[model samples]
Target chain A: MTSHPPAGTPSGIVLEHVTKRFGRTEVLTDISAVLPPGRIYGLLGANGVGKTTLMSLVCNHTFRSGGTVLIDGEDPAENPVVLGRTCFIREDQPYNDAFKVRDVLSAVSWFYPDWDAALAERLADRFHLPHRTTCKKLSRGQRSALAIVISLASRAAYTFLDEPYLGLDPSARGIFYDELLLAYSEHPRTIVMSTHLIDEAAGLLEEVLVLHEGRIVLRADADEARTSAFVARGLDSAVTALVGHREVLSERRLGSILSVTVRGARTADDESRARAANIALEAASLQELVAAIGIGGIGGVDTESFTTQRTSR
Target chain B: MTYARRSLRLYLANRSYVTLIPGGILVIMLAMSLVIGVAIGMATEFPLSAQIQEGMRENNGGAVYSIPGFLISLGALAVNRNFAMALAFGSTRRHFWLGTLMGFGLTSGATAASAVVLLALEKATNHWFFGVYAFDVAALGKGDYVLTFASVFVLAVLSLALGALFGTAYRAFGTKGALLTGLAAAVLVVAVTLLSASNKEIVGSWLGALGVWAAVVVAAIAAAISIAGSYAANRLARL
Candidate 1:
């Protein structure tokens, strides 16, 4: 039972030459991109790849070591007007030990102008959050649920969720997906969510941004990303012949059976060629693309072909 | 202004701690004085010495106890996890810092007011009718109340500001740096205490010479620490 805001005030985020370094460790290096408004942008990446750091910089939760961040055309740092329209709920959000679940909801209501108490209550009930329970006493899943409730109920124009489903079970995750889409449909806003459950969350994303080793490797339409590449398997000669000159993201061989993940769209001609060569053509899932991209085996393929918008800015 | 309003609400939410802890301490001290005075009154009485009688007549207690209220406020402000969460929920660092300052300001004000009220009560009741003082220490009665309040208020504010500065340093520099900073502060405090103890006559003479103006010096210290604290919070704090 998801409720939406009466009116929308969406905001877009722009990062220009953003670089973040902690002490001597450079986390995000000169990464730049424009995340457009009123869409669900998935921030996909493996561990320690600066996905969380990038989100922190855009939300002004952490200061950027270099470059500039503009939220709705204004800097978010110390700017209350811009900050009021943004919410960044992280996986390990530290709530005061003394605060109860109800206290957190009450406090957040004051921070976001468009906050919906009714929606928060509904989400809390659905998530089985005990209003009287202190935040420190909550289970891991309950903590995640509380974070989700805050992110959705705040109704901020620019919402960033860094692994908002860390401890959520499949059923709770399903609720998150359902409620997310329902809320977005009724009150559209820009939402950037980072998650490791790629295939499960792929359907909810309008656009996908894949980060590998602190750099955005691919930024493409979610659907297109799913079909961006395909697996070719058959005899070694046939598979090799079919995958020639194309980027091979990954390759595996067993005896005479050869399989390779090629980077390109699946066309009728390619399908016919695979058929004639007695090869199997299987479309690569977004999960596989993420896995392949993270491991640095794009098969010498031009990433521009997969991404609708590149992050060379 | 909206952020200001947000911070105000945040400050208000934690109002109980600002009032209760100091108020409770004052009550407990008053009760202890009453119990001790009654037990002594029941004991066998001999001819008391002039100095002992004077001591009993002017005895004041718990004047310094209310200072911990600053640490209570600091515990809420410094090293507090809620500030980080508040930022994630959409508060700017400026808002959090301002809200904390407002909260500490109110805490100090309430503590000072409480001290004044207790002082008046002690004076009216002749030190709780048992020759004991719970708030008007050093026989500094109605005429000196304002100076006493100012001194207490300054110390309270300084403690709160130091807490904020320490918390910011901890967040910006991690646990090791925070520990080192804490150690440095502790060492500095210990060194000052030892120096003052070793030069008690000089320190006492100097303090006596300053008279009520000593509170003014403390006020300046408070102001400087608070300004530095706000700067640290605004520039160095991270979520």
Candidate 2:
């Protein structure tokens, strides 16, 4: 079953000063961003940093404490027309106890205005999900695969996938990536995906939003984000000297050697200085960047002593 | 498809839960009642019609409880499972609630219609030709088809509404909230019962004036209250 196509061009999602709190524990605070239509965006953040909460709030699965969420220039909360354009399946999406895989597929097909039965069947076959088996009996990977099939087949205008590849094997994950790209190519729409496998999904994202401690710390194009920070590795004193006054994200020392993740792109002068100081400068990967920003707070410069106590050999 | 229609379809998809299982239970209960009635008739060798009439008069009509029991559980499961699934599939809470109300009405109507059919059959068969008196018992409107339909329909609606209320409460406030709500309801019921007992003459006269419709009116009012409470709780609920 399907309905009429959405009229006019998509206006995309706009969040303004969004705040969420659960009994005084603020989950998302002052989070604001503009996600233009028809692009794949990666929502990156550490565990419990409100990556899931943000997605839920956008999809209106959970109500926001404050701020406005507009989807296609309309509020999504309890608006069927607006919600119909969205699809969000949680990592542990609940299913009826008696619902078999086929039952779930059949039930969900009715809600999405553009549900593709053929695509659903094909994806289910690819995932090898047994139609007769109840969802409670499905394995973790199989459950994830089921969620993926619904998300892809629904073909909603704005699809949000939160840790969609939780328990899938490497081969299955590969299939997911291939299918996701294939689906996106075939039908261009806004997709916001949250995943811990940053580098693996980096190629698919046009923009990356790094959320840290209930706030958006960085939002930039994927290419720009890759060079947003750099790592300096060499002797402690030399690396320290090269780092200078630049904000340090994280630091680690093995014996006398020290490596520090510094914010900002490496300049030509800084590179030459690093060469002279016998320190290697490398552009931090997306994974490294997320870890640094998430683990070490934004502009969290290390001021502790770098001296390593020598042990008796 | 409209969201409410889609949600209704999804909720009613499980025929085994909404119809077959409860229907099967009713049949089993009727069969048991028939067997016991026949055995008593054969062992006593008394006037079968008089014995059956006496049995029917004394019968508490516990068999009718099965349908409402199943419906109540179905309503709760719908909130716990179907509500989340519908939202995931992009359904609004308002639409889900609308769909659920439609589902409750349809299920209750169907069950009531089935009860009416059973009562008609019992009458036509002259109590299954053995004076079983299962569907014709005093608890189910004393063999009155219209009264049975009204009573069963009201009971089913009330049961489903109460179940949705408790389920929504659980969703909005967790287990502790649900427990507190249940406790509060119990206290209210006890208090009402005590007050009614204290003013038995007045309460009895009022109920007698309304006759059979009193129970129906009371159940309908409770159902309405439950529906309102469930909607409020649903508004505050999160997936």
Candidate 3:
């Protein structure tokens, strides 16, 4: 039931039936997904989903209620050797008040043996954080910039960005995206970024993991997932006949007409079938697919994020 | 160049540490205390050695330590209550503790240096260097309060170690933890104060300050355990 990793590289992340409970509430239940090395994977889900929990679990920031996490084929929990290769930049990072911005960089430099100080300095210039601004005085946007700068510059093989742009303005976000892409291209690694702005970040992702109610509802190539699900717009009867014995992700009715999101192939047969029925066929975007699954009750209010198990390729 | 860059980055980014807001209250309080401490010593015409001796008497045979126990409680609260401040660019728990200790040591050194300078100046002026605390004994033996000196040294070390341990715990546990720890410390301080007279006599009279050192020894051990456990817990749960 699991996908194996490609040859010649370590699986960046592997989670098998991982479960996390916060007191009486089960935040993540039996989650199992693999994220292979050298891919930009987008972890998309709505609020209150276990996206952060799963990411935290993989990064060894939080203890797992159940299941095993293997980073570079080693347990990440309290294991310095493994953790050194991973950078989990939290949504709200804490810094000591007595420290200056430069001093902060100095300390983190020693944590990772392979840290790129030059890249960090270059990114620091890009972010334009005033050299003298104490962390407390920084604007919300600046704080987000600091987080982005560190995650990208740290050059950790396994990097997790938990809502890296929560407070960034569009221009600043664009800078973040550009820096991230440029860095990734130069030094490819496994990047699992959990975000709400799916459409805005659509192009940056190579794969998408859609979570619904603590379970993955969709995991495929960004193009494949879209290609797999097609929207067929036609009369109610025609749409009904076309979707026969296939998965209907979502359906909408206006007067006697219908817009049905049916799980089908982006292949020739599926297209010809729609054309033959005289129904307009269009490929679904990641956002549309996510919305359809989330709102269609495929998963309840507390849907978890798409967790990844790493493969070499 | 690397060190320069790191320190610069840390200083620029560490806004949270800015809470050492050079405010009126803190400034006035520190200034007033210094003034009072110096002024009282001058007016009374007491010997500095005599004052250290009084602390020795106060503890019976306990150590002559001068670390305001209140500071330990303050450190615990400071690190944890303002964690977001700590989490900023420059402040991590480890570095914060290190910097704070350095700052404290420098201040204490300055105090000692000033005392020495003033003593030299006094001798030049043909006056004895006055001390604030005078070690007086109604019935305690001469030569020195052996237990008192031992007690002060032991308590200073104990309090410093406890400060680091509790400070870390307070940070990991946050506001509620800090408050709880602070309250417990205050309660203990009061209890210790209440029992000081009799406890000092018992330890000083025969056992000497060794018994008090034993108590500090036990406390230091407990603090070590707490600190280690908290660090492990943070690693296990922090995301």
Candidate 4:
């Protein structure tokens, strides 16, 4: 179900040095950033890098070990006024075993002041979920579809979806993407989503935040992030000469040919220079950039020539 | 909707099974009681006299039948997975705790009212003509309709609050903490029973005194436990 957001500008979530730990294991460390209002932010990271933990911390689902987390510029822990405007749907979120699909929709409609029942009904029909089916009896894909329906119908100002596509088929995922964008267009709000389907969801993101080993290694506009680095292929001497002093993200050699992905803007002059030097330059896609970054720090060999940038606070 | 109102709806929705089980039990108890009443009427020729004789000897009938109702409510509130889901749905801890108390209060009130009606019917019909005292316990009724109703109401409310408290304790401490707490409670009970064993006369006298005001005492204690349980659940519960 899709409807317009509440009447007024939805406030954004601001995290100032947020830190979370489970016992001695730190999950998120010194995370500082301002997630602007009414934009789709892709919280991207490899598994176990604290993407889910970060979403939980933002909603105060779990207590933070240290630092400040302000939702709409106020503390959310036990604050009904602030929490009432937020909705968090976890991947493994549990529903009452006794509740049928209809029961869940009714319950959410009561809790969410802006809940749209018509939209929920439409979503249920589209997802082919039987209203009489008990929550405990739902299949994995059906459960994910139900979650999406609630999140969409709630029209919550700040919505967090962690791995929202866990068990969906390709067609179902496509339906999700289309419905998600349609919902956003109908009712704009801040939506933070975490998923491993980077290439599939890349086009839907306006900005990207990459977390690695409890630390945010990169944050930039999605398009800018894709264009932040480029790859050059040529004879070893020519490629080496062109890559001089630049940050090399990754490199491989095949006989006499050398291929290197380097960081920095690709200017027209650089492109001409590379051509003159018999080098072929190609822009790295967002997926390739994320993959390279993820592979960059293992044993320190992958990123030997790359200089990583932490662009946002 | 107000937070309390929304959360109260959630509480009711999650625990609606409380209503179903009691309703089902009431029907079954009525059907069985009727069958026995008819059989006794045919066998004894005077069912009321047999009922009185049975009541005089045992001093009980079906009054404690609602015990399962209390236990059901307790289990529902204690391990409700929906509590976590409620938080995800944007309910504040305050709303959840308060809503829980309100839900149990209303549900228990209705259950207690039903017990009062059954007790009145049993006493009026001379143990329903089968000498079955389904709702006539000596401590609760003592042949006084109002007193019995009041006692049952008080106990019903207390049962619900105690259940909520147990649930909150389990939620805060998880399985291991719940086990340790259970062990500690068992030890305390054993110790108290042993200590009181040597002073049976004193304990009996004190109990007799307590019996006069048991309803009030239990109600007050239940209220206190409900509040403390809510506070602890609010502070310690994690998603």
The TM-scores, one per candidate, come to 0.87, 0.92, 0.71, 0.85
Candidate 3 regions off by >4 Å?
Answer: A1-9, A97-103, A234-237, A253-257, A266-278, A299-313, B1-239
Please write out the lDDT profile of model 2 over residues A149-254, one tens digit for every residue. 9999999999999898888999999999999999999988899999999999898999988888887887889998888789999999998888888778778899
- Candidate 1, superposed: residue stretches over 4 Å from native: A1-11, A235-237, A253-257, A276-278, A297-313, B39-61, B69-73, B76-79, B139-143, B183-210
Assess candidate 2 and give its TM-score to the true structure.
Answer: 0.92
- Please report, as a residue range, the 10-residue window in candidate 2 chain B with the lowest summed lDDT: B44-53
Tell me what fraction of the real C-alpha contacts between chains A and B each candidate also makes.
Answer: 0.93, 0.87, 0.18, 0.89
lDDT by residue for model 4 (B136-165), tens? 656565556677656655666666665665
The count of residue-pair clashes in candidate 1 stands at 2
| CA lDDT scores, all candidates in order | 0.75, 0.84, 0.60, 0.74
Residue A155, candidate 2: C-alpha displacement in angstroms? 0.7
Query: Model 3 scores what on Cα lDDT?
Result: 0.60
Q: Quantify how close model 1 is to the true structure by its C-alpha RMSD in Å.
A: 5.5
Better of 1 and 2 by lDDT: 2
Candidate 4 has a TM-score of 0.85
Most accurate candidate by lDDT: 2
- Candidate with best DockQ: 2
Worst 10 residues of 2 chain A by lDDT: A303-312
- Could you tell me how far off, in angstroms, the CA of residue A271 lies in candidate 2 after the best superposition? 3.3
- Which of the two candidates, 1 or 4, achieves a greater lDDT against the reference? 1
